[model samples]
Target: MITMVRNVSRWFKVNRFMGKCTVIGVLLAFVAVACLGQLASVQLLNGKSTAQAATASRTKTVTISAKRGKILDTNGAVLAQSVERYNVVADPELAQTFVPTDCKEKTAGNCQQIDGQPVGTTGAAAVARLLAPILGMDAKELGALLSGTGQYVVLKKEVTPEVMRSIDDLGLNGCVYGELSSERLYSNGTLMGALLGGVNDEGAGVAGIEQMQNAVLTGTDGYKKYERGGEGVEIPGTVTESKDAVDGSDVELTIDANVDWYVKKVLSDAKEQYKADWAIAVVQDVQNGQILALEDTDQYEAGSDDAKLNTSRAVSQTFEPGSIGKVFSMAGMLQSGAHQLTDQFTVPGTITKNGQTFKDATQHGDEHWTLAGILEQSSNVGMVMAGENFSNEQRYEFLSKFGIGQDGLGLPGESDGVLTSAASWDGRTQNTVLFGQGYATNALQVTNAIATIANKGVKQQQSIIKSVTDANGHTEDAKTGEPTRVIDEQVASQMMNAMESSAEHYSKFAGVDGYRVAAKSGTAEVAGSDGRLTSIISDWSGIIPADNPRFVVTVVMKDPQGSYGGLTSGPVFKQISEFLMQKYEVPASTPRTDAIAVTW
Candidate 1:
């Protein structure tokens, strides 16, 4: 019985131990399965989101500024350009953590030490102390900027590359950096100042050509996305995305800088000598209608506030063209077969027609003059008689064809001038229109009108921009419309012959040596600042080497000391024509053999 009882006790003890082992194994299996499930969830289901959160903490995006294009003259001279600059930027939050290291050995760049001792300051104060001298700022002011809690702050803007390099040499451990930027620089101070225009603080064009071609001059900005370390340092091989900026296209103008400078100087001198309110001048290539030089007296320094505010007077101001209108009317007469240049007329000093009395500049007895002679003498009565057969519609039609009161150059703030319908003309205005009093036009219109006669009756589109070269170096010439024939070629020749005779009348005052000029002068009464019809506008337009025209020059002055256009503006014409001839090496004029008789 004792052996049986001992065996039962041993068996029961063995079973209980096995049962405990089994329970422990089952618990261990359950714990292992829970750990595997947790590991899968972390590695597969939520891994991407967790990794994205980590990247968001360290990644940063920065702007890469596009370089603005340059404005160049036809001769490849730089008129306006962008100079490389930088904006000194700082991370105020990071700057506040800046700490200088103590110098143990006297080695350069080994430690942040001032005068062979440790920098005795910490955080933003230490940064400010090192940066203030280089930046030319007060240490206290810089410290305040750096003590802010913002991540980004502009320390100084438009710093030169030299200054930026010096700042970089300090090695501020990523607390400060330079953002690439540029400054628009006009190399020639006040040359074409108001016309070239200026940029705003944000580098956008606000006036003149800068505003007109803003799209061509502006570029697309790019960006860079990368990871940075805790110290604001970009991590190696962590740049995830980046795109390079596209620089703006370079614009080349049709103007010659040297000629423009000379024209401006001449206009300025004339404005002072004549004691006039203002003066304007324009020169154009007759063959292609490309404007060579356009200038006015109200010049301002480029990049100045005045440059931003003022419009170009050459294309903006309007006035009666005075007797310069004779060329258009005479062209009309010859074109419509109303009269021939050789036709005879006995013109008195004054005459009345259609209840309107007209007079010449000077009183004279009855003179036997041909149509050509009538024009040479610039007789208002002669034009009235010549236009006896010229219907009002014919008058308006000819003026329209000649581009009077028309849009010119399409420049900013350009005026199209005023030309009322023929139906609006009164009896006095109808006769006055025949002599250039009833309509108003700008200087450019007058210039191109005469240019049409010089171009053998063909009118070419005027162009200021010569070409555009894009960032990829692809070049394209400025687009323009096709030339139009304004009149028969024979009629243009007759007008040119008549104009040559008129030019001789002003030869003493406006003649260019060795060049035959086809010229006309005009003096008109315009409204002054007080809106009184007392102001005098004296103007002269001429084509040099008339037989083979190359350049057409025009000069206009307001309220000049000398009232007559031929007397006041004539000499200016001579000076500019002389320069054009000498500079271009133009051949001297051939003797006139086909000259028509002015007296019948």
Candidate 2:
């Protein structure tokens, strides 16, 4: 009985201890609930909990590409443009099991044979058979692609919209689809090709103005984000974000299409007649520096393998300018008051300095020549005699002022033709440079130098781009720099008069029937395959309507078989000058004259 009582007492004590622990546990549970409630309140005040935010909404975003800009001539003629194209893509795994809508009605084992294909064929075979004719693809080749396990595959690219429309009519969405894209199209084929440049497969500009101004021509692409439904369709009115694509701007070039086309024709003719390796030409407005025409025989067709070749020979190719460079030295001499148009010198047939003898292209006996006569006769000996009047430093300054050894008129790949400073000039180098040798210059630089004379000693920055029109229809004019006076107006006039004498007395081929022309012709020796000076670069540059000074045209033909600039490039300049006069309806300012004397 005592043992039973002690057991009951211990059991009571155990029960009491258990009750106290249970109460303590309830208090701890209450504290945890209160803490959790406070945390929940804080989170609710901030907006959303991390887990709830993650599961709150789902969105799918899609990118829309902006339309690439158009490259247009000053006349609004499209030079380079983006054309709408499509890419044929497929989900190969899905396409392998996809059934055409037309075949759906023939579920009784004949669906694979709907297109007269083999029976019991794979879904890919059926799809390929139906699409081959419309897509202009080989059925067997296409079937191999469709039967692949890849989820994404590009079947074809750059298909026309009409073909894409026809494919859409087939209702093969689950198997094949068309993605909208763009490809550049050149309307003129190879005309102004190098200047306009070409685009790559990614629809980005790769060369010429297309590359230089890509950022301005390439617009911003936008996107739209919206919630998707269970079936993968966008839920109605559940768009989370949206933005419109900005189309690329329109690049209006300074090139006049009509004049440029004519110049190209002339260049082509010169290339054919001269049988030369290459030809280049440039026409600039003296007052404004607008490049009316820039052409080359090495032009390439856009998007063609030929495009990989260098095409803008006018800006890219440099050569020893030969006699044409003499004009700048003459201008500099006159501007510096070192010489006058009336200064006379008895020029020997040849002059020697530093173990080098300088002679005119054509040998002649000693003759007396006035300043004008020196230029009219294109006497290298006379040029050398006058070159001694200026120090080496002064001569170098003159060349620099004439735009030699300067970065070209803002063109890609334009060479800053080689020019050794006066500090490095030797006796032979000095005399050679006096008549345009020992240094290199591109066709445009030569043209710019002559244009400076035509502009009455002012140098205007040359420009090929006229304006840029943005997507919003806003047009920005080209920032052609202001004209900087480089010489006295009187000196420029005297130089022009002497050039007129040259055209009338020596370069008769450069003169127009009714228009006064001031011009110079040059022939420089180019090494041939035999390592001898058997090749020549024929070149001519001039200003028309000498009294009024309207246009400056320069032409170059390299390695012509048997001709000089007066024979090959002169006619080209004349034809183009006549066209420019007629196109602009320019009136004859001064009657053509032939009274300029080459000798006393």
Candidate 3:
């Protein structure tokens, strides 16, 4: 019976083995047919698709961003710079393609589980949702990104470690970190915000010197080419080409940090102390027209609704300079060659021209004031009496010559200022303008006017840049705007003498202090709705260590806690000039041993 059972078992096993062989035969035949069909399609029917796929396999490329250039103050202190950052990337396609080995606990089919929750916040719909919060993104947005069909996708371009940790919790698949270029911080926050400007993510300059010299500041990008495998990792021995990045040039500015800081500090304080709406300050070298320090912090801060820095006023604000305009008025008259400093005028405490009533700040009845005294006390009437020398046409010409209508500062949104043609002038315009009331001017114009005076009647259009260096460190003197001399040297010296006299009295320089301090102070009632003076704006301009004058500085305080220009703007000027004197070790221009020459 056992023999019979064994025979039956063997027979059954043979039958089962035969059945398996038959099934294997059929499958092999079908696979052979499919392989032949694919071969035929590639060899003859439509080989273009195969060729394109192969070519694509050979063209993988990578990018390396160049580092950003440096920004330094005139003294070479770093202001803004660049550093390396990272971008996170993921291969969702690879996550789908991977397969696990027998020993591997994480397998291709269930790799999504290893990927944890997707980056998106939408619980089930997203691959990136899990990473959204850590990366500072909306789950819905990340989900949409992951659900897309791209072979490669940027998960996050800029991220912190705090963000990376959150992504790790997600257990995402095919996640990778890549390097990117970014801006480094400035130790000095907002110190020269307007001047230095900031960079965009793509490293493009938006304003100021940064924008002006972008080509030199931006470095060349590098490239890498390699054959990518099916999983998108580089194939071994497949790198064909690479080009290293060229670093950008380091830039240096002529701006002095200390000087800029001082200017900002004093002007910011004055603006607050005076409750003034705006303030502007400038310090420039007389030997060459390099602006050392320039600030317009108050108006912008007030507009910002905080003490924080914002809105640049230096190159922006334009208003009627009021009596402060007298500094130029005196210069223009002197430049016209018809005026002298000793010229005496019997200012009857007022002067009437074209039915306009012009009076001094306080009435000093019918007293003789020299051209020097008129400017010293900032007398509006006294200037009108002395202004008889230059014709209206000559006055306008002189104003234009000194860069009133065309300083060519070339600042964005720069104004031509308000100088209507004198030919269209009314009695009110002429008289009010005579004492610096009718015309409007910009901060640049005011500084440029005094700059012209400091430059000995030469209108050296003000510039802040010293030189622009190329990527190779070759520097070309910045494209300099031409200087137009508005007055003869002799006349300029005379007018400077008058200014010196005025400065001495206002500053209480008891005797001829060795320093040739040439200065002028102005206070004009800010004309309200009636087109007449009622309130006030105070301003001051001067040059110090007068002989071989080194610095020409202009400080203006608007609607200060006090009323007069001398009181509101004077102290700021003193502090600034004193600092500069000590910094530069400026000695007084030898005390005047004899009579000094001046023009009205």
Candidate 4:
């Protein structure tokens, strides 16, 4: 019995071992077959596709746009500012499940129709309905827009934060919101429109002072990307990418909003009163050669679309300034040692030169007048005689110093009022230019000429921006100085004296009061195609508070109802001078020096 039991045990053990071996072999065979299949698939079907897919994933990159800089006035007032906006998006593929409607469903499957879009569906229609009202768009249109096969598509851009929140609560399937940035408001609207300009849809300034100083205004951008789990929870400190954005430098303008407002108001009112074709007004800080206010009323309104036109007539347009321009001729004579304020001109009220008659403002003609009296009366003949005394080269040099035909200034668009070469000044031309008959100049160039005298004969380049603000609320790059010299101090002094005298006399005549003023008015007939004066167009310009001048104001009246500077523009000038005097607390000009002596 013991021998039989041993034999059975041995057989049983052998059987068990064979069964285990069979199972192990079968497992090995299956693993080998699977390995072979995987290798073949990689070589024949997956290698190139995998490589191409990876390349495609890395090929196209996405970039977030940076926000532009802000523009401010001298007082740290926001002239141009940037605000955050949003773009709404939808995933049509996922949005098909929600129904678009006002009713809420008890379960995800039961979606309602909102504005005709199925909202409860996890499809594009629901996303469109939930977002359409918040975005102020037609849901039907939005759905159509989302019907695009793209994995992601934008529905609307520049959406405010409020709208973004409303969309987020809807929880529409596949709907996402994106963020964009742009400037929101202008402080004064169109007060300094021409100077501040505007940024593009991408927030880049394309014109005006903004474009001119982009380098200083544009800032850098920064970004952060972190690894997030499926539920939007951050994997602690798992920062994927990070970059910082630099905020743009703040730009401060020299323009004073109050002054600009008044200037524009006065000019615009004058435009209506004179029934003029156009009008321009300007005010400057004589101390630093900074332009306080520069405006043209006939061209634009504070919020009108037409105001955005590119023409900077204030710094671009120049014409014969008529009598107002007589001051420059007077300047030339004084600078050239050719004439004096005391020098007398023959009594003829008119000068017949080159078969053209130049008439003085007064028809009841004074018999003879001093150089000062000639300017006071705006005598064409007087200027002609004085201009003759100046050699052509001498005349050109004097005007040249005033920036006529010069290629420089504070703001852009400096028109070198046409200065005929000495050779080009024919005898007729010589007399014609004396009373501002032939030459043309921009308002800024003319303003600068007066500014030179105001700056004590030194013309500084005018700049609209005065300073920039840093991140820490500290100011930087402040333009805190005066312009370079363009004229002799004494010459400027004499010019100021003459202009003040004229202003005082005119103010007296016009019955305007409360300020010591000096001014000159011009009513030059705009040139016609026939090379003769046209009755249609007229202009006026002058300096104010003549002694120790605080402001240089220029008024241009085009095609006035009266068509004369003294009649149409003189009143406006006086009103503006008096208004500015009170507004700026400018002390009345009490000349400390006796009038400048003219040398022969």
Candidate 5:
């Protein structure tokens, strides 16, 4: 019984050990299966992440530049425009190993021979020989560039479409590339050059209206997002996103191209005739305040390096206005009820006031003169004596009212001109101010200031831009400011009478055949460093068909060789006026009148 019991105990111990082993084996199998599941999950997640990364790497985004706007004149002629240009690029390595596939009857043997490498020099020479004449380049120079080690090199820039087409017909097979580009072209070279401004290679406006209205002239750039292939090439039918570019708006100016051409021609002739350092001209519609022409001799090409330095002198430069400014002083005195057009005063060759001496343009004896005669004589003493009736405050008020030192006309570099405040005036300055001295003004300011008289003392704001047209063909007209009454109609009419008489003094140059004309001529001395007269600013301002006064024309010349305003600028003003009258077909307002009295 004990043996049997021991055997049972041993058997029971063996069975329990086997049971434990079986449980441990099952646990081990479970752990292995859990570990394998976790590993499989990690590998699956990693595989998905890697695939996503690979897909992301194949995507590319391209930005497309918007088409720049056009700059058009009032007559819808293109003054400045963005034109399609190209850059010729060569894959030197590809060119070195090129094989011309276009085997025409005339080039088959040469093409086939180019495919062979008998000479140590690569096939670049063969390619250059075929491309040289069409590209306007020498074969040797082209061969050297094509034989270089670089993968890509620029062969030519700003090539014409015809040249590009010729290059394309050669079938160079990845050896040559024509990259698209643009250039700013001025249709009328050097006409309105400074006002039209310039653009860079990327078609960004850098100066003038182009710079001032760049945002309006430059459109929104678009973008394209596409998937690329493994070789970094665009994949077929894989564009993820695309947005078309919006072209810029077109800017139409108030300047008439035909008138501008004529004015420039007249000024050029005057500039040459007078042997002057600078010449400027401007024409305006006195009734509407529209500037018909603004020109200066200092002009430059659109794409030239000198463009940055060259600016419109009429807009930016200022000089002593000289006798041209007297029109305003006379208007002030008349409006102040201090003088009448027929009022008589004894005028002398010179007058001294507050230790400052004023004189007539030339030596003359004392004589009785009417207001009209005083102006016709352009007497500094007469102007000072007439202005003495009004206070300094009255003179400054008139100057400001006449548009002196007013806000800029919205040009890029417009000047407001100089007008001394009453508080800054000394005895000399106060007296000199009466005769249009001790202050300075630009051509535009002087032209507009005198225009107040021509417009019957209605000051109209000047403008350059006429309208803006968007890509969708919607045009928005540019607003010109309202006209303000600066003087009474009666006062203006009386001033006009005096101006007509004054203009008659220059009748030799200003008188138009069968037409009544009103004008004023001035010669202001340019002060030297020692406060003495060194140079002269000669100018003429006038109205055409003086009886009705449709247009106001002004001509200014600086430092002319031995000439005054009537001699240098008067002829230019007359020619411009005649051309304008004929061009606009303005009929005669009244019969021609005799010369008014200069001395009484």
Candidate 6:
């Protein structure tokens, strides 16, 4: 019995020990299963989100600026262009977290001992000290910039690519970077400054041709997005997204840079020689109305504040056309069958009719004059007498057809010169209109008006831009409508003959030796700075090689010492006409056998 009881006790003790082992095994199994679930949750269910979070901490995005297009002259000379440059930028937050490695033996990394001296500091201070010399910035100021909480700051702008490379070699990890940028460069300085216009701080066109062609001149910006390492440097092969920038299309103007340069010089010299307040000149191709050169005395440097403030005066300012109006009126008289170029008149120095008195520029006795002589002498009284048969509606019809008071060239700040309807004309204004005193017009209008006769009574739309070429090499010519007929072809020839005799009047001072110029001169009294008629606008318009017209040149001067247009602006007309003939190798005029009888 005792042996059996002992056996039972032993068995029960063994079973209890086995039960404790089983319980511990079950607990261990439960813990392993729990760990497995947690591992699955972390490695599978939330893995993508976790990885994205880690990347978010180091990812960086940078803007890549597109290069702006160029403005080219007719000869493909660069007028305005963009030069590649860089803006040195910094992640101030990253710079503030930077810690340099200790220099025990010297390694290929930034070290605490910069320039062989223990940098006595950490974080932003150490970075600024190393970068100060390279960037030519004060260490203290640089440190202040790097210590800011902002993610990005521009340390310097418009640095050359060479300088940008030097900064990159310093390797402040990802704390410093270079952002692609550009600087606008005007190669010709103030040559066509106000006309070429300028860009703003953000590289947008604000005036002149730059503003007019902003859509073609401005390029779309791009971006670069990538992941960076803890050192703030882009990891190898980590560029996640990027787009190459599309450069802007190039604009080619009709202006010949050489011609424009010469014209500007001539005008500048004339402006000083005459002691004029300002001067403007325009040269147009009679066939196409392409403006070869447009210049003014108040030129400003491109990309300058003056360029922003001032506009091209050639299309902006207006003045009474004076005797230049005689040509239009004479054309009207001939076109309307009111008078013949040979019709005789005894023009007195002054005349009074309808309670209005009119006089010539110089006091003179009665002179025998024909219609052609009246124009050559720019006789206001003769015009009044010749226009006696011209009705008011016919007077307005001719002026309107000649493009007076019309929108010009579409340049910025261009004005449609003032011209009241003929029905509104008073007695004096009626006579004044016949000789070019009661209305106003700009230089371009005067140029085109003469060009109308040169082009056989057809009017061509004026164009400054010649063509546009895109990045892929496609080109589009400038758009212009068909020419409009303003006068009969035969009438234009008759007027040209009459003008040939008129130009002879300026032979002493304004004649081009080889070219037969059909020209007219005008002098008008305008309001001065004091609002009185103390200022004089002297203007001359000439069609060169009158027998076979090629170019029309118009010159205008304000407050000139030489008060007469024939004296002040006429010489300028000669110089420009000679240049055009020589440059284009135009043949000399055939003898003027078709000259109209100036005196019958």
Query: Which candidate leads in lDDT?
Result: 1
List candidate 4 stretches off by more than 4 Å: 1-32, 35-65, 91-120, 226-238, 298-308, 352-357, 364-366, 407-414, 470-474, 478-487, 508-512, 528-532, 535-542, 589-600
Error of 1 at 394 (Å): 1.2
Local distance difference test, candidate 2 = 0.81
Which ten contiguous residues of candidate 6 have the minimum total lDDT?
105-114
All candidates: TM-score: 0.90, 0.85, 0.81, 0.81, 0.82, 0.91
Question: Could you report the Cα RMSD, in angstroms, for every candidate shown?
Answer: 6.8, 8.6, 6.6, 7.7, 9.6, 5.7
Per-residue accuracy of model 1 over 1-600 as CA lDDT, tens digit each: 999999999999999999999999999999999999988988899899888999998898999999888999999999999899999999998889888777665646646765666779999999998888889999999999999887899999999999999888777888999999999999888888888899998899998889888899999989999998987889999999999999999999999999989999998998899999999999999999999998999868888899999988998999898998999998998899899999999888898877878899889998888888888988988888888889999999999999998887888888899999999999888888887899999999999999999999998888889999999999999998789999888998988998899999989999888889998899999998899998999999999889999999999999999888888888998998899999999999998888788887
Task: Provide the global lDDT of candidate 4 against the true structure.
Answer: 0.67
lDDT of 2 by residue, 1-600 (tens): 999999999999999999999999999999999999888786776446664464344465756668899988889998888888888877686677765443455454333343553434547886687678878999999999888886667888989999988776655544677666778888887888787777777777777777778888897888888775432345789787889989899999889988988999888987888798888999998888889899898768765655634546778888888888889988888888888878878898998877888888788888988878898888888998897776777788988988898975666677888998887877688888888887888988899899999999999888888999999899999787777888999888888888988877644666787788899988888677798987788898989888888899999888876567777888889999999999998888666453444566
lDDT of 5 by residue, 111-202 (tens): 43233433323479877877787888998999999988976688988888888987876666657867666567788877777777777666
lDDT for every model? 0.90, 0.81, 0.68, 0.67, 0.79, 0.89
Ranking by lDDT: 1, 6, 2, 5, 3, 4
TM-score, ranked from best to worst? 6, 1, 2, 5, 4, 3
Lowest lDDT block of 10, candidate 5: 112-121
The count of residue-pair clashes in candidate 4 stands at: 44
Better of 2 and 4 by TM-score: 2
Q: Whose lDDT is higher: candidate 2's or candidate 3's? A: 2
Candidate 3 matches the true fold with a TM-score of 0.81
Tally clashing residue pairs in candidate 1: 0
Between candidates 4 and 6, the one scoring higher on lDDT is 6
